[model samples]
Target: MRFNRGRRSFLLGTAATFVADFVLLVPGLLSGRSVRAAGQPVSADSTVITVDSTVIDVSQGAASGALALVTGTTFNTSGTPEQGVRVRALDPATRNEFARVFSDANGQYSLNLDPGIYEIRANKSGWGAISIAVTAGAGATHIVDFGNGAPPPPPQEGTGLVTGTTFNASGTPEQGVRVRALDPATRNEFARVFSDANGQYSLDLDPGIYEIRANKSGWGATSLGVTVVAGATHTVDFGSGTAPPPPPPQETALLTGTTFNASGALEEAVRVRALDPATRDEFARVFSDANGQYSLDLDPGTYTIRANKPGWGAISMAVTVVAGEIRILDISP
Candidate 1:
């Protein structure tokens, strides 16, 4: 199953306006392809170049081989969809440009390429540029959003920057994981953001001690304590150590049910989630099917089951499952 999780929203201050222009000497394209804009170019040799209104079409080149689709949206520092953002795919080893396109008014773009590993770069005028490595598989569509790497305003007085990456149990960079910085004494969250496609994240906070935690659904969480120093950048990574051994198999219980609306009619597309009461960690989540049915298999334990839909109030109930037993719990309203 494919999941296109939403990117984290950022609250960045306004950026300085500048003029940028550069030339791209792509192998097949015309030599000295100059892109003229009003701002200072971020990188003269950048593999990706942003154009004001002109879009260089390279879809035909990509269509000549086995096809893989790359699609995503582009957002500015203020978390607004940005139009005309240029997205380019290039060969990682040789830095050769493969396909190029510009985002639409909705900040959405798509590119076709041969199945392989490539560096994808996204850039727009007045915003910072970003490049991330991605593996494109034949006939598969991959999502890569350009919402990070925006040059943030200078840090405030006595504040420092915290930056790091999040990895999974296998030590592979994991995207869309939420990272939070909290005050150790009060346990109040100071800042929170999701990692980018490269599994990288950054936070700016005042000089103080904080507990940084990284978490994602269905994954073990890792955290640490760090002291933020004035004018210094601290690096902290999560789940980058050796992978732990697999756990022993345990007996599981089945939970299944149907959902109905307040009017006693079957309801579809309701989100059902089960959470561990002690740690408040989510154990399973699924949406009701067309028949208003949902199911989950979990280890024997007590759980808080909650069901909610967009236009209705949420419903919650507590239940305990027994090993090798099937439990039926229906939800309404």
Candidate 2:
């Protein structure tokens, strides 16, 4: 797998906190302190493992384009325990996964994922996080570590912390609203917030100019522009667009000739769906009509026609076309 291993640049003097008052601290566990110059020692029973929380700054194709890797090492213990570590990035209404890394002799692993809320789990290490939500800006890095070790507590002095809440235009609380606060100069989404039942959210960001937007459900979303002076709180809200239109029908690739099982038998009742590649959304779904044949009229673009049968395998092929374009596809498993 292609893993983007970018060294973290900035470290948050304080350890990671999944939420308020809930620190990722274990009573007897003191894994992180200082092991800069050389590699640290790995004991058969490692309770002290250093951690690093890196804030990523990125810009590219989609919001899900910026990907990074998270990793660390533990000693070669006599009995290998499944760390049970799971890592994923958080979007407004969804959680996307990069991958899960299990410890080995070197006690190391990593995940390739984009920016957003990242929930990590280490059952064997007594570590659990709902989602270490992150809003990394392009080219910027924030370090967050949790394992056998961690950093010290946050200092009283403000390192440029800015905050605020999100609400709909009607002043109603918007849950799962995708709020992005961007730093005008760097164009980096410094801090991100989501409205609670009270239409509230907050972020710890550096002092500067920001452009915040609100995404509410059912109603048209709004973008509220504001500036976050040194250490201050700013409130903003907008109506999310009308309930997103109903999801279109599922899509299936069009089949002209015979679709067969590995044994040259006609494949029947294969589930197929037509897709709108541009949005990756489905349009319509159906069984391969009686003759083991099917047709799909996809929204002009690129599509991967898929064919599947219970006792047989599945096959898919990519087809590209312009508006009102039609293509034929066949499958054999």
Q: Tell me the TM-score of each prediction against the true structure.
A: 0.32, 0.28
Question: Which one wins on lDDT?
Answer: 1
Give the distance in Å from residue 332's predicted Cα in candidate 2 to where it truly belongs.
Answer: 62
lDDT (tens digit, per residue) of candidate 2 on 1-333: 011122322232333311000011243222221111123322222222233332211111122235444444322123232243333334433443333333444444343344444433322333322222344443334443333233211211233332333334454444455566664334456545443333334444454444454444553334333434444433333332222111212332222334666877656567564455566565434344223444443344576666676877777666674543334466787
| Residue 152 in candidate 2, Cα distance off native in Å | 21
Give model 2's TM-score versus the native structure. Answer: 0.28
Candidate 1 clashing pairs?
A: 18-39, 19-38, 19-39, 19-40, 20-38, 20-39, 20-40
Which lDDT tens digits does candidate 1 get at residues 1-333?
A: 111112322221222121112234332122211231232222222233223222332221222235676767788767778877887877655667776666767787777666776667776667545555555777667666676433322333467766677777567777767777775446677666566655676666777666666677855454444556677766666654422211212366667777899898877667777788877787666565444555555678899989898996699899999777668888997
The CA root-mean-square deviation of candidate 2, after full C-alpha superposition on the true structure, stands at: 19.9
